[model samples]
Target: MTKKILGVFVIAFFMAAFVLFAEDAPLAPSPDAKGDNFLLAADFRNAFAEYRKLLLENVNSPLSEYYFAKCVSVMGSSGGAINPEQLLDIEKINPKNAILAANLLRLKTGSFLKQGRVADAERVADEMGFVKDWLIIGPFDNATKAGYKKVFPPETEFHTDKTYEGKNGKNTWRQLSVRPPFGTIYFSNLFRADSYVAAYAAVFIRAEKEQPVAFRTCSSGPLKIWLNDRLIAGIEAYRECDFDQDCTAGRLKPGWNKLLVKICQKDGEWEAALRITAPDGGRVEGIVLQNNIDIIKKEILPAYIPDDSDTQIDADSGAVGYFSKLIENNPDDHFALAGLAFMYDFKKILDENDKTVSNNARKALEKNPGNDFYRYLAGTCDEDRNKRLEALLQLSGKNPPSAMALFKLSELYSSTGGGNSGRRRAVSANEAEDITKTFSVPMPFREEEFLNAALKQNPDFVQASLALVGIYNRRGTPWSLEAEKISKRLLTLAPENPVIVRLTYDDDLHTTAENAGHYAKLLAVDYTDGNARNYCIYYLKQAGRKDEVLKEYRAFLQLNPFASSIYQRMADYYEGCDEYEESIACLNKALETNPEDIAAFEELGNYYLILKDIPKAQENWEKALAVKPNLPDITEHLEALKPKEKKFWEGIAANPVVYAAEALADTEVPLHASAVNCLKNEIIKINPNGTSSTFSQQVVKVFDEKASMNINTYP
Candidate 1:
């Protein structure tokens, strides 16, 4: 009884402190003093209303904005559309609300997608960037909180290490990529299961301007956050994973700031998602989120050239120069040599810039004969095709082969004109360009074999899985089932990986509206990637979401207005919906965008025929045919629509519908016949639901008005 009273007293004291704190500044309690209670009671409306009232009371409060955004977001997600402007308002009030920013941005994107405002959603996604990568270290036991408490006596010790590896005496770290929406990590992935784990994740954000940034985080277990070594917020007990469950506001210095997280998990699922946002709960513009220590260090380096260098050197050159200086001091510096070789490899034209690359790679390999990276570098620098292959083959033969080496080997084996003895090379340029047929010779080395070897060496390696999935999706010998299984496994392992999602989408194994939306969301975790656009658009169409399809089509065109094909696609979609005017307009725009778009001309020809403009139809079809003399469908279409003689009509009379269609095409004489004949022809072209047919209503209205028309005579 005494202990219970003491606990009550402690809670009361904290509540008092919270009230006092609110009066002093804008901090609010989490479990949210009132909002969480209302939400728990299933009174979402009241919860949302209460949060809104709090926001109105304190416009600048991160606490109020956070709760309000959450309430609105929940309500919006449940069939109600959220206002993007309201979400943006939260950002304006507390830009450092990273969790809220990411959540609200997601909510806003979904709303935009549902409302057919995909462009707005895409724009907001670009603006509200998620902290996609983190230097993750852990799986240290959290038994009785022992592991969590002792992992780092003070978390700052982890940050204090200046090494680019970001490793300290306390723990070994791996750079983990966690994209937004669903990117997560499992304790079992790195350590034994059914055990407690303490994980540390940290990322560096370089802000362009000084502002208060919010770090909103969600995790499966208890976690604490520190900004630039200053302890800011912490949850000491276990909890279920929830989005934006905890957030801490901090002032980000104009330049670089470090955000560190310590998560304590007790068995079961383990994961976390975090983001940094502007004071108003929007993206902190000009912020670069980085996990790679080398990248973080390089980003923070002074932009000005060293006084010794005569000319200005960009960051890349500066990096190269720094390594060059290191090499000048010690010619046998393997690290410097490896760095130079990697830089050259990144340039993608290693053969063109071979001066120091080959020498440096050779020196690095000689110095570290056992290092796979050194071997890989040497292999990249080796100009001899046979020698390069030999080095790569040797690298792959290591105890645990590098994924890069395996990937390179796969590429060499897969390429038709390379080391792979694939069939039929081009006798001429025209022959090479013609893809009408293909011949193949069996490859000496199967790409799939090496990719499978890479996967066996490191099952968690995503690139290997992706490569194998690609092989499974190869044109003639597509192994769709294997691809689907691998893709699903990849998603399970790395939920937020856009590359995996791209492959999954490419295979079209699980194409649905929801999956497409998720795929698009995953893509948004990175900067706007055009690679997934077609898949996203295709999935939406397959799911019968015409509104979303059109919205995305418009959005894509906004970004790439010169894409004539997109305009043609838009026209096709509009025509499918029986929006003839809109279809015609799209075709005209396609022509305007590119006069030589043969497909657009063909589509316009079809549109003109539907409108009964025989001359215009013929003109457009002729133009299409002129562009490409052998347009298969165009010639057939033109021939089919040509006016036929009585004998031809008789020949096709068994198909009366075809005869009626031909008769209807003769617009020279109006058919003042009973409604049945016209209705018969009209029914073939109209959708009962009125969505797919523009003339459904007009046809019905005409039928109603013609109620008095002759029942048995043609006028």
Candidate 2:
């Protein structure tokens, strides 16, 4: 009884936090604090009602608009389409409300995606720069409230497939790519079976150089955030999930920095929202989201980067075996079958002749005769879209209807079939109990009369094929495999169609680096087009094609030379290729475009360093440090270059952990070069066993004094 009352008091305190704004803050809380309280409590339904009143009271209130839009977003409903400008421009990220900046990004991106404006959606996603892609896993025990503080294995290190002690017997990390109408992770979806639990979400954001970045995070329960395994935020208080509720300044190192978030579930809602922005709260450009920590952790990725196919095979190995074993025990395991099929499909081994996928699906269908889901998987076994469509059509009279099947069937009809069935769209899963609940006419469709009429007469009907293509575009998700299956046919039919080219790019499993050719096709469709411009430049750069980079650089210049990160990247590329002069020219252009380009300043210093122009290199390094202070590498380089800086007194022997990424980064600056310039001898010592013993760094160093560090082994 005492604990429950204490919980209520804590929640009330969190709700009151909304009213505690800085003095002279322009915007205040709602006229009545009820809505604010409800919002802080994660009570979106009541919050929605309250915000509506607030909005009506002051339509011009950006605060009201923000809260109202946030309520709609949290509630998983599209109240109506409001202007993106209202979401972006009105809610400025400033002293009073720094977190609103990330909120603006999420809401803006979600708004564009919801409207089915894919090109606009893609642009917003790329440009707005807050991470929405995350791999989340959990339901670790929190029943006794200890879970909130418990350090799980994921906190120490994370593997996507590693199973740890979850609330259940077993749980592995699953990709929870949060998208539209979901600015926050609604953990209720992931941890449905378990309550009083905790979950962890992780993603890596890469920075070209050490730079300052601001972060805003909030959760419905106790929350802890770690950046590169350093605890940045830890809020033990369970509060309403509101963005910017806990805003803090953070720094990103010169590589991928892991951002791991843990949110505990105490009661009503389990949710988390986080965003990383520029220190000034604008979109932090040049930052990219990494889906995995392979390169960062330096565990799996070796000296050379593996092709995508090899990587996918490595990823699918665990799932394939786990699900295969489950199916052996219970052949009717729909989930196991689904998991197995997924792995097989990803592995590109799902063939009708492939023993496991086909035979297991066939056996499941034979036993549970005419089951919608089993039948669907059976059709999938054909491994052909046309045949799959035929199979879905045949499922019209299946014994037990599934809402998922019904949705797919409706989509199939929306493309190939005609639904005179007047089926109100299957909106909810419960409606599967009675298909008639959705359908005004008969449950089973007359395929000859109502379905595939276009394809029956002319199989190559372009419009029909295009409609089929539209069904796979998921909300907030950039890629969809279902769309990719039919992409080839559409591209062949209308190779020049801009939509087809763009959609194909979205679904293609191939990296943008491999699909750099899409740039020309998209540009040829409309040279004035800017949507594919960024991606095209990025693709060419990633592919390391110098000629293509120059070509795209020219094309991008024509589109918008002022907004050029392309040239800065090109500078990096040129330096890599030893084209120092060309890199110098690119850096100059980059500096011209973005005067505050710290990367350009840093790289120019690097180029000058190679050219042996000490004065020029030192000058540029100073400028770089001036732009973004507290960058240890540049500061170290500067300190080393300066005559008065710390000098090695000889006999400086030290041990350094050799990361796979560094040992193999560059042949020019190998281990000996570091040793020659040694603050310490970074020896790669091989033990008597003929292998180097792994040594983890135990010394601590903080470089607050002009980002300078002195690691004295004998200090």
Candidate 3:
């Protein structure tokens, strides 16, 4: 309740701060204006004081009452709760009220929907011809980013017994009533991670007779719609969501017509909107929205099936639920059995490793053996990569070919090492991240062939388009020009897609300040994206605002407190500026966040060493080694500092040999234009018989102010 009140106060504050009035009004701020200021300043008591004065003076004033109610709503008081209807009635008394019509209508409709008054919501929705009710499900596992192209079960059939492997696991259709006026199905809370996600919103409308209607929908993410199991209209772009954004004319059957929509979100808001209206413009009347899948199945779905033909559908258009039902009634129905087996793509029921399931499917295939698609499903469902590859090969040979199979074939080729593999997971010391490996072109012919074929088969296939863009992007030639065109094309398909954003920019972070906005968008979608944060930091630094860089770092930390690696990097930044105290504090915090952070321990040791705190240095290095043994540099450094007869640093005081500051290595650069003069390699054999030829040199002397050196032969 407190949080809700706070949110309301926050919103009201902004609204009040910008509230405008008539030009002829007095110059000084009005009571509503003063109240708004207090709300904005977070002085709730003062804000309420202003509201009370306004309500007392302007008795029965709609604007005054609205402001008072707004303040009360956020104060956690139920005594004078907001009455949207009363407020609306008050506004009606004076046609020229201070409150905007849009704002009033929104509040009224929202309140109605929040209270489960769908009829009220529908009444409000009638103004905009928006659909008020829908059966919605998902935040499905779209981590693979196949939401747009891959056909999930909902596309084939809709049944209560059916469930999809959704984002929350095993999701079935549930009711969603939109907030009134806008009809926005706000699903901002559905996404829990920063990954590509997909959802389904369905409405089964019963028409009096066959009729034509326009389907209207909008979203801030990639969206697609289907009517009665056929693809209709879609826009796979992340644009501002608004009513009547995309429209398509769809035919409704006499019985029940299923309007299925698939929407994909990469980040930020995971939401969608849907509405159906008459072809001419007004609301489609006399249509009942079927809320129950079972009822729809009984009274509607069966009617859509052809009366002339039996239960036969094209191989590609097979419905899993219908086939399962047919097979249940007749166990020996080989065709139905095969059709059911072909639906191995569903992760809910078809477990690839289940022997019983596989045997049953194989038997069904044997009853009607040599079915290429059945074989494809068999191998495609298996965990073995070789099997899937062989299955994909079979599909690739088919007449006209399969776009999906060709796409998968290209993927296999890329992973096995040719062309640009979209992205790979690179695990850091603290977390794993999707690292886009933007490789250069000169892709293998086979990989290129498969991708081009896939695109040829289905030009709008998103995954294939992305792959081809990746390929064209790598080539430093006219192909890059082509890549730019295709990249723009792909952006239209999925503009907010992190992958698309990354590919579009392609490591050109030095363009202008405008480039930072792209990373800002990336961070908005994924706050934990270290790469985006770094780009932001880089741009901030280039702008000569070191403080802003630190602010950016803190902003990311606020979103993800367990980002220990960020703390370590912060430590490095401070240490570079010779702020030893700040560096130590950051390192300590990193250790606190991740106890076994070996890098932080090693860094703490390095800081201690520079500060001439011998014991402190020894302790931290020992701690680092304890976390993970066999760390050579830490082990050697720790032993050398352990109560030596003569300290090891006594030597560095004399010779002052500097080593790598980061990870230890024996790697060296060749001599460039050198001005510094020094050093020679000397071989010291402990054994009298060990000659220079027989012994390996443990330490070689080198010379350079930056990096270089030579050999000193003690002949």
RMSD of each: 27.0, 25.1, 27.6
Candidate 1 stretches with Cα past 4 Å from truth are 1-340, 349-372, 381-383, 396-457, 466-489, 498-544, 612-662, 665-715
C-alpha positional error of residue 54 in candidate 2 after TM-score superposition, expressed in Å = 16
Misplaced by over 4 Å in model 2 are 1-126, 159-161, 174-183, 293-715
Q: Report the lDDT tens digits of candidate 1 across residue range 440-511.
A: 211224677767766665565566677677667764344878888888887776655556666565444444
TM-score of each: 0.38, 0.31, 0.40
Candidate 1 vs candidate 3: which has greater TM-score? 3
Reference-based lDDT, residue 225, model 1: 81
Model 3 TM-score?
0.40
Q: How many clashing pairs per prediction, in order?
A: 21, 1, 5
* Top TM-score prediction, candidate number: 3
Instruction: Give the total clashing residue pairs for model 1.
Output: 21
**Which has the higher lDDT value, candidate number 2 or candidate number 3?**
3
Please give me the total number of clashing residue pairs in predicted model 3: 5
